[model samples]
Target: MDSLTHLTNNIPWQRLTTAYGRGTDIPQLIETGQYEELSSLIEHQSTLWQTTPWVLMILLQELSKQKPEQVSLQEIQLYTAVASTINVDEMDSQHAVETMNELLDEKYLWPEDEEDDELWWEEEEPRGYDQEAFSSYFSYSYLLLKDAIPVFTAIMEENDKLAPAIQELLLMLQSEGERAVE
Candidate 1:
């Protein structure tokens, strides 16, 4: 438990498997591909907003840079379409999450009583995804991965203290992501 918390405090996503492996010795589950628990564990621990999202984004960015030949078609489209739309360079996770909600999920507070022809609007407000805090959260994640995703990857892969091979597939995907070029 304490070890998991320590691993959670560090981000880039690659370290999760190692953290798990260290605690549990069942590396075969990774080989068998029963990794849903791994994902669930991550999400469960991340209710407070984890930097794994940035790890994902970094992998995407790296993928976009690398093997353009093998990049996911969606990645290409997203990079082409939303790259310019989003101010990623200046985007803080808080603002980004909030903006994401605003642009994607607009919330409308509805009145109790409904009218046939006449419409009643009670309140329309932005469901802020608590944007002020995650800004620094993402910034910290960026700093963690600035060196290379593999820095964390190596740590996870080699750390016998962690479940070592837990996120084997995700690490594989992220490793494949290194194909991006400058």
Candidate 2:
């Protein structure tokens, strides 16, 4: 198997987690070019983790290494998945909706006893937040995307079908203050 096929299997997934679960499923999903699964695993209703950008960086590096003439459907799917995953929206309404859904699912809005409801809300407030870690994730994501631009540009030149989406991704990367405010 190619190195990319085995890339995820080699990761220390025990120490990492995605929006869904342990990171073990990631390598297999990417290797198989399961774009839908990958999107669900990393994109929809997901919270950004410290390891998220690292995974994206590795995937982009692997994708960028493929020769344009040899670009496969699987490669394109993987590229699209990674691109969608890292393209953070300037307005994070999706994240807000996810948070609201989680709160509802956990019944955080209604307590078993009214007396304990206030305490629940108080405890839910984030404490000791790590702003640096959040910033680092975005910074790393930006740097990785910047490094992959040349490779993507070359690929886009060869694959016109991918040009528009790739161009959008490049623009997104170049935009300043694209990060969502917490």
Candidate 3:
């Protein structure tokens, strides 16, 4: 896995949309280890955004590396709470993830190319926050977390205090994964 710095630098934070607005501040906050502010930006009132999964991934990595007693309760709470919001609907997300992956490949999250001399005309379309797209985004976020299950599993084994929460999250992820395939 890439170091948090590498992942933080490589993602197009300016282009990615978060719950509060553009994700321009995310990299700075992450580098500074300001997760409380980070949480507010990616998740709002149980709604997740394009930045949520990526931030959560980074948080998981950081949390798993820390000594169990040193883990931030706030960060753990944020991780599990944000996770509870991921509801993958019946959108064929296996296919959506493929589509999203292709989009990421082509820099779909970046500003679209245009010959417009007008700045307003060149403005990027809003990150699709509509119903279907939101479902797809949720599905995409679910899969990202699903990929990190082992990280949680390892953390569970090492931390007695955190095991119950991590186990609950594992159960949630497992059930969600099963539902995605059904």
Candidate 4:
């Protein structure tokens, strides 16, 4: 089996949180060719989730296996959405993992009762924004996508249909600005 299959089998998708809820259905959705729903679950209003990078990794792996002409429109759109969601111009990939690790160490907190809807409703006040957690989440996902630049680059070269958008993404990642990962 390929690496994507291996990862799909091994990763704890049920424990990963997405916009709506746990990512228990993600692997099944991918297996059933549900790209649109997958897109919605992995990202919401530009926020990436714990599952986003893994999902994208699998999708990219599938894309790599297909002939350029055989790539589906849904797949293209999913990747385009990813490109739009990430502001790679602001990232420092070399240090992203370190920063993510530090932030995660400081800010990784999940409520113990995730499935308790009544408990959620019992909370009178919403939680405050945790910037460190947000930054760590973004940085981790960004690094994962950044590491797939070679795959994206190869697709850009071979798939004329996706080249322009992928080119823009590549440009954003390759920019020399000194901005730290946000």
Candidate 5:
């Protein structure tokens, strides 16, 4: 059997849990062409578990090997779900602002007056989630599946439903690329 088939069949679903329930149902969900169910399982609110990215990588690899004309809506939805989970647009703006602020600080330049600085610092809340783990997963997933991007892009171009998610994925890829080059 192919690697993708092996992966889907062999994932330790009983020990794994998604936003909903046991992950064992995931392979069946994909096999049965249950896009919505798969989407819900892979993306739970603002949390993308480590397992979700692994599943997504396998799905993308499977889809990428297929002819462009043969790609299914369920597959595209998989891409959309993965893109939504990453939520790169939200991260992009926030990261840009933070990076800009850091650069200014390093150069001894302040964008705001002393009072504004104090107010902003006071308002800055501690992140309640593990941002590092999320970032690491996102970077690793993108790098692992970068080769499949063009396939996703083609799907996005032909289907309006995929545009938003594909766009976010592209933005994340671009941002990651820039960071790599720097």
Candidate 6:
């Protein structure tokens, strides 16, 4: 299968692109020839779902975080490959709600307890998250993540541990401070 097809097999980033949509930067993040940031970010974001979202949570984290720099374009593509839902497509936000609902069901994000031990139990699929949280700002749903990229980009700026290359890229890419956009 083609590489894009392969990446989607496990996470379906293209489906995410089609489902939620993203901005031009989404592609740039994936195609920037950056590997360490993409890989590390993928690991960090993936951990969120390791217990619940499994795949969905990682995608969310990726959308939430900024891509580090001095990596490889292939690596960025790999990261995006796994994303199946987005906050915004090319033109407007779409499938933001459905993607979250599907993620809720697929990853079991909502839990009776915030510290549920068996949250990571293996099964045919995961449980659903709190649907009452379907929103564009407060909620952790796809649409909210997508709609709030500008805010998150601003937040990424003040982060300290970020690599200098990545920091510079963010500043240069309009992904830093208030001017950083969604």
Best by TM-score: 3
Stretches off by above 4 angstroms in model 1 are 1-88, 91-129, 150-181
Quote the lDDT for 110 in model 6. Answer: 36
Please state every model's RMSD to the true fold in angstroms: 15.0, 10.5, 5.3, 5.2, 13.5, 14.3
Using Cα atoms with residue i matched to residue i, what is each candidate's TM-score against the true structure?
A: 0.24, 0.59, 0.70, 0.70, 0.58, 0.24
Expressed as tens digits, the lDDT of each residue in 92-182 for candidate 2 is 3222322211222322223234344335336634211134344444445555667887987898899877777776666665534543321
Residue 111, model 4: lDDT of 49
Per-residue CA lDDT of candidate 5, range 36-141, in tens? 7877776777555435655776777777666655666666656555665554434533322222112112222223233354443354431211354445445444
Q: How accurate locally, in lDDT, is each candidate?
A: 0.32, 0.53, 0.66, 0.65, 0.56, 0.34
lDDT by residue (1-182, candidate 6, tens digit) is 74433433444332221111211123334434344434333333323222112232343445454443322334323333323222223213322344443442434343334344244233334343132322211123233334444643454455344334334333332322435454
Candidate 3 per-residue lDDT, tens place, 76-163, comes to 6666667778654443543454454433444346354322324522455443443545555667667767777887777778879888
**In terms of lDDT, which candidate is stronger, 1 or 6?**
6
Model 2: residues with Cα > 4 Å off, grouped in runs: 5-10, 45-47, 69-129, 176-182
Worst 10 residues of 3 by lDDT: 113-122
Model 3 score (lDDT)? 0.66
Question: On residues 81-163, what C-alpha lDDT tens digit does candidate 1 reach at each position?
Answer: 22222223454333433332222122321222334113221223212123443343343433333434443344334444432
Indicate which candidate wins on lDDT. Answer: 3
Cα lDDT, model 3, residue 122: 40
Q: Which rank order by lDDT, best down to worst? A: 3, 4, 5, 2, 6, 1
Query: Predicted candidate 2: what Cα RMSD to the true structure?
Result: 10.5
Candidate 2 positional error at 7, Å: 4.4
Which regions of candidate 5 fall more than 4 Å away from where they truly are? 87-136, 154-169, 176-182
Q: Which of candidates 5 and 6 reaches a greater lDDT?
A: 5
TM-score of 5: 0.58
Steric overlap count per candidate: 12, 0, 0, 0, 0, 18
